[model samples]
Target: MTDLPHYTEYDTRLAAYAVIRDDDGRVLLALWNEGDQPRWTLPGGGVELAETVEEGAVREVLEETGYDVRLDGLLGVDSFVFSPAQRSNGSERPLKAVRVVFAATVTGGELTPEVGGTTDEARWFPLDEVRGLPRVSLVDVALGYLAAG
Candidate 1:
């Protein structure tokens, strides 16, 4: 849990994880399904009770992206307060979500479209091309850690 926007009693909130593949400075991204528009995002999901944040990240990557990964390091966190118009699943989601982003590696598993959850598609976009694409700035933060390493 890195420095994140606080969400206490303001509204419903949850914690999530973000996993970035260290590509010697490049990154892997996919166009997501659970967004207002098609947005490229890292692999992750909401944290479940009785599970650690890192474990959630691992499970989420496999579930959302069809890849078994191991958490390598903590990149940082992102706390988002979304409007109902932009909420994923199209309901009033948590007022905020503290995303515990991590740097991870592909341990095994084949990438396929079926594993893409609600995503329209799954493909890895390089780091340099990310900013130009329709992606959130949080992706850039994850990329910065990858570049430093």
Candidate 2:
């Protein structure tokens, strides 16, 4: 007789993000050094334990972009599932991510880079020019909601 181990485990992650823009139609973005290449993405990160989604978005924005923002409202929600190779065992693990997006306005603070973090720098980019830059999928999804409303 042959014996096989069977188990199914998935990680459910919750994250929050913001779509922030300026009067000149420039959108704020953060440079994330994730893999072999860095990409620009909306400012946000994983929701912390005991923190509301809105509060998480606000905190992540400040941590990644050094910008204090006032959240205008909830934009939308996005969810997806993917399998990533586990570094420890070389096995594939399913990750389901649920993201909450919000529209925000910059209240104060200067543009600065996050130190020793997933994000390296933060800057404003022209909306028209964003499509040409390397960016995360969340950027477009968030912008779609903002444009529709």
Residue-level lDDT of model 1, residues 1-149, one tens digit each, is 89754655335554555655456655667667655577877777677888888888888777766788877788777676766666656575346667788878888887755343655455676556778988765677667766676
Pairs that clash in candidate 2:
none
Per-candidate Cα lDDT values, in order, are 0.68, 0.88
Model 2 stretches with alpha carbons more than 4 Å out: 1-8, 86-91
Off by over 4 Å in 1: 1-9, 22-25, 84-94, 114-116, 147-149
lDDT by residue for model 2 (18-135), tens: 9999999899999988745899999998999999999999999999999999999999999976556532234367677899999999999988899999899999999999999998
Best by lDDT: 2
> How do the predictions measure up, each by TM-score?
0.76, 0.88
